[model samples]
Target: MNLVIVGLGAIGGSFAMRLMKQGYDRIVGVDIDEETLQLALDKGYIHEGTTSPEHVIAEADIVLLTLYPGQIASFIDENKDHFKQGAVITDVTGVKTSLIRDVERLLPDHVDFIFAHPMRGSEKKGIAGAEESKFKEANALITPVSSNKEENIKKVEQLYKDAGFKTITRVMPEQHDEQIAYVSQLMHALSVSVVNSTQASPDTLLFAGNSFKELTRIADINEELWAELFSMNKDALLDSITCFEEQLDVFKNALVNTNEEELKDFLKKARLQRKKWY
Candidate 1:
């Protein structure tokens, strides 16, 4: 029942905290960020913290990685062989295809690798952003290949549930990436674009309406990490962006032609569609 969580940022820190609160106390955390690791230890999110991946892996029955999309493969390439035999491994990386594909090829047969994405996080970063209930009511997509050990898959699913997540199993990594691109990555790019576009004069900023502010609030983004995710899932994200651009262009044309009827119809349809999700 011991767990090692790598990269103790927002998601990892929150996961560790929730587990400790639930009395799963045998947790060791690993992060390259010294300040974040110290913060996790200080906040009692982790019983221990270290920079050595091998040290952390040696002690745990399960490992949960919360590194960026690009870092996941490199971490596997460098450390998969060292993981304790039969250890259940999983991740919180947003993009799945690349990491899942690489793990399938590189991971030893004895160590199990299951992929997962907890479907929400704040735009905020670091241990300061960690909340014990962050995954409450969040959709955690559990991905286990056919070759994965059935018992281990169940174990990982239980882990997510124990951490307060509502879990859904998704077998195909490619399908996971396609869905995430539209639901997560594309929305981030759209928010970033709007925020950047609206950076006019300060006087113009003061005149912004509530709707404008709400729509573009997520534009305050972590560009470096998101850029990696966007590039990793380029094809899917490009298709999403293109589809959205086409619709936005339709709106643009409506505004130029003073087509109030079409604009109203579009808004009404959008409202109805959004209601379905609620």
Candidate 2:
């Protein structure tokens, strides 16, 4: 398969690398950054690298976009005419609902845009930060509409599996966004908030426990990208934030009243939910 991966940052570079390791050889990496393209080439992540995708995209059987959530639709719209007929285009962006809604109509009638999220990545950026191990055993979610071709959907699933994802779950776009708001985006929001909340000396962390470090590890975020992401899914994220606030208030009330039973109840509820995942 001639797979053209656009925006060769960490996710795209890692996708190219891992898929190549799996023996998919006709892989091309595209990025506006000359340095990133060179890095991917030097690392052998992609068989070919380019600064412009106009020609490669036209020839591709599959295109994997790892651009920011906001840039995705615009990129597709600008390049839709170049897409090969029946080509399968998928993405690794976290948000889905609006993207699918926007691009599905703009895509060539013969082409398919299969929306997906890889469920994990590093806070680090660039081709240099790409690592195949990041996708190991990670959950990959495919948000395919009923109109999507069964063949294209399967191809997207196999692509994620080949890249080292252990599980593939199909979800509707709306449902996917809601769940992501709670699990992925909400966690990032909490981490960023916690890290920014600190008014203490920087060395305070030196005296802190592992849990604090672990909890806030994701706070070193890509601000522009995440701001676009949060804005794209504003309603769902706002709902998630409100729910979190309600729960936080429960903890605060328990502490203020010194109500041991209520505190135990809060812990018990959380434990039960955590146990469900385990």
Candidate 3:
């Protein structure tokens, strides 16, 4: 099968690298930057590379769009005519509900768009930061709508399985957005807020411990990509933020009132809840 990856950034490049290492040689790469396409080829991540997606869309059996959430629908609409008949198209967009509706409406009847989110990434940026191990040891999620064929769903799931993802869960798009808002988006927001809350100089970081470093690690984020993700899932994320702030108020009021019992109960509940997560 001819596999084409669009927007060969960190996730796409890492996926191509993993596929190449697994002896899949039919991989092609599409990107807006000529240098990036050349870099991917030079690195042996793909057999061929192209800047013009429309020129080669018809050649793809599986087209993986690694573009940002905001770009996925428009990209499909612009090149819908060129996609091969019965081809399976997938994406690595983080947020789902709204984008899924737009893409579902825009896709050609002959093709299937199986929306997904690869639950692995890097604090680093672009193709330069791509690492095969990200997918090798990570979990993935697929949010398929009613129009998707069962065979196509299996094909997409098999692709992730082949890429060495440890788990690939199937969930509805609305559920995906809600859960992701809490687990992924809200965590990133918390990390970003924590980092922004203080003016930490080089000297301050020099004194930081393991927990501090660990919590702020993801603070080295891709601003434009995350901003788009945060906006795309605004309602869910806002709900998550509100929930977090209420919890913060609980701790604050305890501290202000010197309520040791309340603080103890809160810490105990937090520890118990965290244990359940594992």
Candidate 4:
């Protein structure tokens, strides 16, 4: 099976290496960045490299687009004509509702555009940081449209399983994005805000506890990519942020009013709610 991965960064390069190791021969990589393409090839993640999306689509049986938010549709529309017949295509984009509708509308009838969001990533970037085991035990959410074939969905499930991921299928694109905004995007925003809010000096840094360190772990995020994701899913994220702010306001009010009973009640309820979360 010929598989081509576009945007050979951390996720793409790691997936390519794992699939290659699984005995999937005929692997190709396409990336606009020559340096990244050369790095993936040098690391043996790809058998060959192509700077042109058209060339990769022409020969690949399956294509994985790992581009940034809003970039996938343009690539698909530009090269849909070159995609091999019956080829199964998938994406590793973080947000689903952001593009799935438009992508489904534009893709050729013969090609399958199964949407997937593997719930795993790192603060690091590039093929140099890629590791095959990164997908292990990671939760993969597959969002398939109506036109998606059952067989094609199964193929994607097996591919993730072989790469050491545990997969679950979520049919609707909007549902996928809504869930991701809460779990992934909200957490990143919280971390970034927490870290930025604390303009601590060197002396204050020495006083940081383990809890503070853990809470702000994801604050060192990739700004460029994450900014795009936040912008694309603006409404959902804004709602989440607004809800969080309201909760914070309640806490602030309780503190200012010196309402011990209310504060205790709030803490108890928060503990109970957190206990129910997985």
* TM-score against truth, every candidate: 0.92, 0.96, 0.96, 0.94
The TM-score of predicted model 2 comes to: 0.96
- TM-score, predicted candidate 4 vs. hidden true structure: 0.94
Off by over 4 Å in 4: none
- What's the distance in Å from true for residue 86, model 3? 0.5
What is the per-residue lDDT of model 1 for residues 26-124, given as tens digits with 9 covering 90 to 100?
Answer: 899999888887888887888988998887797689999988877887888898768888898898878877777777888777888888888877688
Q: Report the lDDT tens digits of candidate 4 across residue range 178-239.
A: 77788889999988887777575667658899988888899988899999899888888888
Candidate 3 TM-score, true structure as reference? 0.96
**C-alpha positional error of residue 242 in candidate 2 after TM-score superposition, expressed in Å:** 0.9
Residue-level lDDT tens digits of model 3 in 102-199: 88888889999988888887777789989777787689999989988999999999889888898999999889999999998999998988888767
Candidate 3 has which clashing residue pairs, if any? none
Regions of candidate 3 where Cα sits further than 4 Å from its true position:
198-203
Off-target runs (Cα >4 Å) in candidate 1 are 167-171
- Cα lDDT computed for each candidate against the true fold: 0.84, 0.89, 0.90, 0.85
Q: What is candidate 1's TM-score against the reference? A: 0.92
Model 2 lDDT tens row, 106-171: 777878888899987778888878887779999999998878999999999999999999999998
Residue pair clashes in candidate 4: none
RMSD of 3: 1.3
